[model samples]
Target chain A: MDKLLRDKKAIVIFVAPAFLLFTFVLFIPICQSVYYSFCNYDALTKPEFIGLGNYKQLFTIDRTMKIAFKNSMFFLIFSVVTQLIAGLILAALLTNIKKGRDFFKNVYYLPCVLSSAALGLLWMFIFTPKLGINQVLAQFGIKGPLWLMDTKGYIILPMWVIASVSLWQYVGQSMMLYMAQISGISSSLYEASYIDGCTKAKAFRYITLPLIRPMVATAMSLNAIGSLKFFDLIFNMTEGGPNHMTDVLATHLYQQGFKYFKYGYASAIGTVLLVLCLIVTFIINKFVKVDNYEM
Target chain B: MTDYIKADGWIDTFNGGEGAFSQQTYDGKIYAVPLNIAAACVFYNTEMFETAGITTMPTDWQGLLDACEKLQAAGYTPLTISAGTAWCLSMLAGYLCDSEGVDLAALDAGTASWLDSNVVNATNKMVEISKYFQETAAGDTNDVATANFYNEEAAMLIQGSWAIAQINGANPDFENKCGVFAFPGTDGRVIAKSDSLAMSATTKNPDAVIAFMKYFTDDTAQKYTAEVGGKIPVTTVEYDASKAPAQLAYVMDVFGSAKSTFGFYNESMASTEAGSTFDDAMVAIYLGTPVEEGLQTVEDFYKNNVWNK
Candidate 1:
């Protein structure tokens, strides 16, 4: 078996199917998008090469694209940070619990199983100014700001509200990742620490944190990429609105390509997003390398 | 392929008001069939109006406000709008622009600026109307707004005549209880657009598709549009006016008596980019951006992105 696995012909045969699948699924569409980004095409007419014109116009005249970039960055940073921290805390707590672990796990992960669109609508209803949170607030003689309709506090309030909803929906996912990593740790290490009079908090900081660093990096990278391309929840909830204040790059690309029939311009935005995701993931990979920790 | 299709006698012969028909044409070849001449207007609940004591339909801007006030006084939300879909809000802005006489042709010719005082006045009026909308309107989607009207929670919906069928579909009896009216303006002007059917230039069965297109505009289909869909029929086919849906008759009457009518502002524009800019600009005004500055965004969009392309 070892000799067969080491053969060059066997290696090619094993890798070919996945390689072909990736080429057609991801590589081909990306290549097409890159080609379209340089042309002026509206789907009804033949593409005319405009060469950097779409990018120039997007950066200069398209105001919403700028706002989209800002909003995408906010979601990537704020939502990722909150989800990671909350997931870590929850996972740590769940690990130490003696009973009802599966019950709590199922409860926490319930939202993750629901569709993003459904979760978005639920949050939208919860935030509705007329009959949702505001009505509840009014009963206590308190005035609540409009959650989805807000424009003045739009850049701050609605963004965080959406981020929190996203956090609620996906913290279970990160928690599961953290739990898997935490479970793989040898129990003997913790016993040794206990013998040396190490506290649980101290053990976590010195041992668990270092050992799980690779998993954290993986979780962060995955969450960051997902948030960067965030569309469905935001599209269903706010639709990048109250004056385009909540637009992420994905929604902006859709508006340009589908709504406005500017295929070339949308392609340019898509290319930028794809490039940005690749660079960020690469940086995360370079920095967060896993090694066996020696205490 | 072109020779084969042309040999099969597939030529578009649809003709209507230039604005209504031109959307489906390109380079002097008719690419589509004009199905219905539709207009944007306010659909109101008749029972709600009587409860609010609005006896006569408004024909001017001030009277519309008075109706809204009465409706509000009667403890009903006066208007249900979907700001979540920005174009619904823009319909109001477009009507105001029509009232202000912002010549779209002149705007296209680069002879008029969106920042003109008349356009500013129109934007201000839109802001005034925004106050009467439901408190949750800014967060509502088109479906939600329709549900508000269907459930009798709101008195009015500002939408195209196409919403008539939607209303009927939601509640079969809503057709009799509902009423339609043109947007009140200084000169009784209204804005219109159309639903059209277009054929693909390359087709496997050009003859079959062309036959269906013709059948789609035949007398029976035209009358169904008027009687059932509440849409205005394009062809000159006489149907019993009394048998038409009450809302349909009212819409036909409004179009008949209108002092002027313009094509929908967004559809009349050269490109969808300009159309979307107008929608976003209206949203800006509704969000309390100064009227002039809001119009300025459209002006910038038009001058920089749309015009001279």
Candidate 2:
């Protein structure tokens, strides 16, 4: 073991596969993107590099890119915060309840078990103005505007609705992570709190919440990562419609890369997405330091 | 999906009219039949009209509104669409542009601008249509119109006719009930969206393919489209409008008078972002957005994604 650890050649062999994978899967594509971002390269012809041209256009000239970027940021903030808060509340509720707890756990976890494709179709019926929940609302004499089909400004409210669906479908994993962390905290701490005549609220505020902080960070980080790549349910639902009002980066990448065959431009968008995700996750880690904590 | 040849001897005797280009080429060539055709028309519910005591089918824009009011007053939703498919909006946009006599091809090819006075005015026309019908649209569930039409929840739907197969695939006893008409926009010209089957570069059986095409376009296949499928066959064929099912006769007439056919213009023809940006602007306008700001967003996106870059 000592000999192997001391051998630089052995260490190099161990790190080589990961390094090569990072180069192939991440670095090389990003470098290609950085190069393409300067050019008006539409996949078919030879690329013409004009230096920072694409980036400059995206900022100064592109209206849709601004909307795309804003929509992505909206999802990132809303999905992460809502899912974390909702998950924590449900997880905390489950941790306290003594009866029918398993049933509640299964019920709340059901959306996670569903494939997004199936959920999207089912939700369509629910949101359909004629045949879905909107129709049901109509029976009670309530006329409803088109929900997903309405593309007028929401003043940020539609973002809330879309984010809620995202959070609903995903909170299970976060809730489970938080619950697992809460369970691992020493029971003796709860007993000691009671012996000291601390209220249940005080015990929960100080003991349960602080003990689960690391897990909260982990859940939130995962949620942020998820919100950034969101495509399927959004695709199946609005398809970035009411004229691409609900469009996101991943789906935009999909359309440009495959449907339109603008490979270079799509790659540039993908590279920007990767950098944004990395920066966000790094900032999160800096604040919480989840990896450094232990129960 | 099933790959049986339908018996070559039987195909030879049964009728070779429908395959057209495919019929002439395939046996001497590498491969075979059934190319795609795009179909869009105004499909309406006969049952709804009957229930509302309306005898004549709505043939123009005002006529469509009159029917919508009649149907809605009679306790039915006037129109239905599925925004989930999304391309429907662009189809609507295409039809709207065609109505205005603005060549969508020119628009797609960079010869025309989406924000041009004509195109913007056309878009305004569509927002007017959206408001007129108060169309009940949801996700990719336009086929819901088929049911709503049958069940009398909605009176009409504008959709691609390829969906005729999917709609009729259901075993509902709609009494051979639904019919189609050419798009009636701004009352100036009538048109339909046509789907085509482009020849792929890779073909091992070129002669067989040409033969199959010829066979498919023959009268036999054309009749199959009218009588069995209710789709408007491309090749000209003589048939009795009265002998056809009630729902299908209107389609033949509509197909007969089509001034010019268009395809899904925005997604198929525009640059990467133009169609998408235009699609969003349309939805915004439909939801009561100001045309000035909406067109500005489209113009900025158009400049960056197309002209400026």
Candidate 3:
């Protein structure tokens, strides 16, 4: 094994399959999208080279593009902040509980495993004004605001509703990561802190949180990328409707590419989404400050 | 392939007569067989109409508005439409545009703008009637909106003939109470579309494909198209009117008496993008964008995207 690790040829042989697979499957398509973003390709005709035209239209004249960008940014910020706080609290609570820790974890994680498309439909029914939530609200003589239909503001009500749903479905993932990291910590540290007159909250703040920094970075990057590319939930819920008030970048790209057959423009949107995901991940990694804790 | 199918002779045999093959023709050559024709019109609840004391069917826009007023006064939601499904709202906009005589040819030719008086009036008319839509109109899917009509929660639904199957299927009891009429003030012009089948240019078995295509227009299938599917058969065929869903008979009468027929504006636009942009613009209007600003979105789309292309 030591000889194999030292050999350059053995290293190439071991790594070549995954390297080649990544180049063909991921790298090539990304390059093609970048290329298509600069052309006039409609998926039916041969691409005509029209440099910067699609990007210009997307940035300047496309009104829905602005809405999509704003909505995506909203989702990214909302998901990161809420998931971190909620997941950490849940993790801390579950760890300290004397009973029902596993039960609580499983219940929260159940939504994460279920299909987002089905969840989207279920939530759509629940939020529809004449039906689910509003129906219940009416019995108390309260008129529920159109939960998914009101499009009166810059960031509309439906976007907030979708963000909350997404948070509900995905916060479990971050919680589990934090729990794993928290459980790996030495219990002796808690005993030592208790002897030193440190409260459980202070111990959590000083010891558990620092030990979990690496996991937090991992969980947050996952969340940032996931929320930036959010599609299925919004697509199945509102289909970016009430006049595209809820369109994120992915939904806009889908409508342009598949529905409208504007492949070139859609590719431009896809490229922008890709850049956003990368920049967000970079920012999250930088801010979270993951370090190798000698625990 | 169109070259392999020998469509001209077969198309001539269609019972719908000369114009039956018109939609399938390209450069004087027929390439596909249409299974059924569909038209968009208003389907109303007769019982609800009677309850509202709407003695006369609306013949014009004012009468339609009056009918809505009476329905509202009688404590019924007058209309149910799916603004969530953009195409459904756009179809309604198409009828209004048809009634306003917004010239598609002139728009394409750059002789007319989408903000022209005719287009603006059509949008204004749409906004006026939209008030009668159910409270959840902006978020209801087509299925939900259709369910609203079949469940008798709303007095009327403006939908394509294809909804007949869904409506009857969801509530068989709705059949007895449903009535149909062409969109008011359109002078009987109906927005129509057809389900068409075309042979693949590379298919190896042309004879087999042709045999399958012929079956759609044959007497047995054409009759089923009307009696079972509740759609207008592309080929003329007679079936027992009593056996068909009651709404089918009303739809047939409207289709038969139409003074003119036009395609859905969203489906017939220069490109799918322009059509959807048009849909988005219509929805913006529905969601309370000023009519001029909403229509301006489409006009700008046409100038920047469609015309330049």
Candidate 4:
């Protein structure tokens, strides 16, 4: 078995299918997007080589690009911070409670399993000014500010509303990851810590958190990538409306590529998004400080 | 191998005559046959109008505003428009532009700017009229807006002739209550769209395709267009109005009386991108962007992206 593992032919045979699939499906398309970012292709016309034009326009003159970039950054920061803190708290609470743990876990994780498109539509109704939440607010003599339509301010009210809804839907996944990591830590360590007069909080800080650093890195990276590419919920809710205020990078890319047929400009946006995801993931991995703990 | 159908000889037989070929013609030749045409108009609830004490329909810009004021005074929502769907707001802007006589051709040719006085006035007028829209107009979908009108929550909806079918389908009882009129201030001009038929230029069986195309504009089909589909047939074939939906009579009257007709501003733009940008600009105005600023964005888009192309 050892000799077979080291065989070059065996390695090649094992890696060939995955490598080929990756090349055709992911690598090739990414390369094409990078190439297209520098060209003027409208799907119907032959691509014209235009060096730095799309990028120049995106950075310098495009107001929508600025809005999209700011919104994406907001979503990324909002998602990562909230998911980490909320996930840790939920994981700690659920782990200590032996009774009805599964039931509580299922309740928290339910939204993560539901379709975002369906959830977005449901939330749209809830947030509509003349409907759901606003109607309840009206009953209290409180005129609710348009939750989904308010376009005032830089970040805008709708962006915050959407970000909160996204957090509600996704925090469960983060909680589940942290819970799995917590449950994997030996109960003997907690027993020893408690015997030494350590509080539950101290045990969580020294034993549980330090041991789960690797998982935290993984979860943060997952979350960073997910938030940067966030599209479906926002698209279903706003389609980047109230005059493009809620547009993140993905929806803006969609508008440029599919709605407007500016494939080259859209590719430029896509390239920016890809680069952003990579940089964020790298930062998360580097900062997370995962030390191998021998349990 | 590449020869488009020339329907110029038979074009005059259509309801709008040669004018119906406005969309189907290219380079001094006709390429397709229009089967049915539809126009956008104002559909109001007759009961709501009577309750609002509007003795007569508005005929011009000021009168329309006055009518809206009356409707609001009577505790009725004056208008229900879909700003959430950009095209619906853009359609309203299109009518305003038409009323102001903003030359679409001139704008396309770069001879006129979107910020021109007429265009600016048109946009301002749109903002002025938007005050009477339903409370959630900015977030309401087209379906919701239509529901507002048919449900009697709103007194007016600016939609196309195609809405006749949707309105009737949603509430058959709304058949008699709904009445149609041309958009005020356009002097009876309407924004029109049509479904046309064209044979493949390279088809081996041209005769077969032609036979199929003719069937669309034939008496039976044309009659069905009005009676069942609640659309305006392009051909001059007569149909029984009594057999058609009651709202059809009002729409037919407006269509018949239209002094002129033009295509949707969005559809008639240089590119779909330009059209969508126009939609965004209109929606921006609806969302309280200054009229000059919103129109400037559209002008900037035309100058940078469209005119150069």
TM-score winner: 3
Query: 1 or 3, which is superior by lDDT?
Result: 3
Candidate 2's residue-wise lDDT over A1-295, tens digit each?
A: 9999999999999999999999999788778887876776778788887776666655676555666778898899988888888888898889989999899888888899899988986776677666677678888999876666655564244455566777888888888888888889888899999999999889889888887888877887888888998887877776666555677788777777777777666767777888888998888878985443354
lDDT of candidate 2 over B1-309, digit per residue (tens): 112234343234322333433422334442334333335777777887888777887667677778878887888777765544555655777777766777656754567766678877777877766653435654434565455555655677777766665666563465366867677763534434433333445778755654665566577876776666666655556655554445555554665566545446554444646776666666566566787677777766655555654
State which candidate has the highest DockQ: 3
Worst 10 residues of 2 chain A by lDDT: A151-160
Q: Compose the digit string of candidate 4's lDDT tens values, residues A194-283.
A: 999999989999999999999899999999999999999999899898778899999999999998888999999999999999999989
Against the native chain B, what TM-score does each candidate's chain B reach? Answer: 0.87, 0.71, 0.95, 0.94
The candidates, ranked best first by TM-score, are 3, 4, 1, 2
Off by over 4 Å in 3: A7-9, B1-9
* Better by DockQ, candidate 4 or 2: 4
- Each prediction's whole-model lDDT (CA): 0.83, 0.68, 0.89, 0.90
Docking class of 4: medium
lDDT of 1 by residue, B1-309 (tens): 223223433332223334445656567655566788777788999999999999999988899999999999999999999887788888888888888888888887788889888888888988998999987777777887888897888999988888877888888788788988888864877777778776777688877886787677778988888887878987777777776767778788778887766777776775777887788788877877888888888898888865776
Q: Write the per-residue lDDT of candidate 3 for residues B1-309, one digit (tens) a residue.
A: 345334466654565555776667778777777889888989999999999999889999999999999999999999999987889999999999988999887887778899899999999999999999998888788888999999999999999999999999989988999999888899879898889999876888978988888888788998898898999887657788888889888888998899888888987887777788889899889988999999898898889977876
**Per-prediction DockQ, in order?**
0.58, 0.50, 0.66, 0.62
Per-candidate TM-score, first chain only? 0.94, 0.88, 0.97, 0.97
Q: Write the per-residue lDDT of candidate 4 for residues B178-277, one digit (tens) a residue.
A: 9888899897798999888777767989878877877887889999999988999888888999888888888889988988888899989888878888
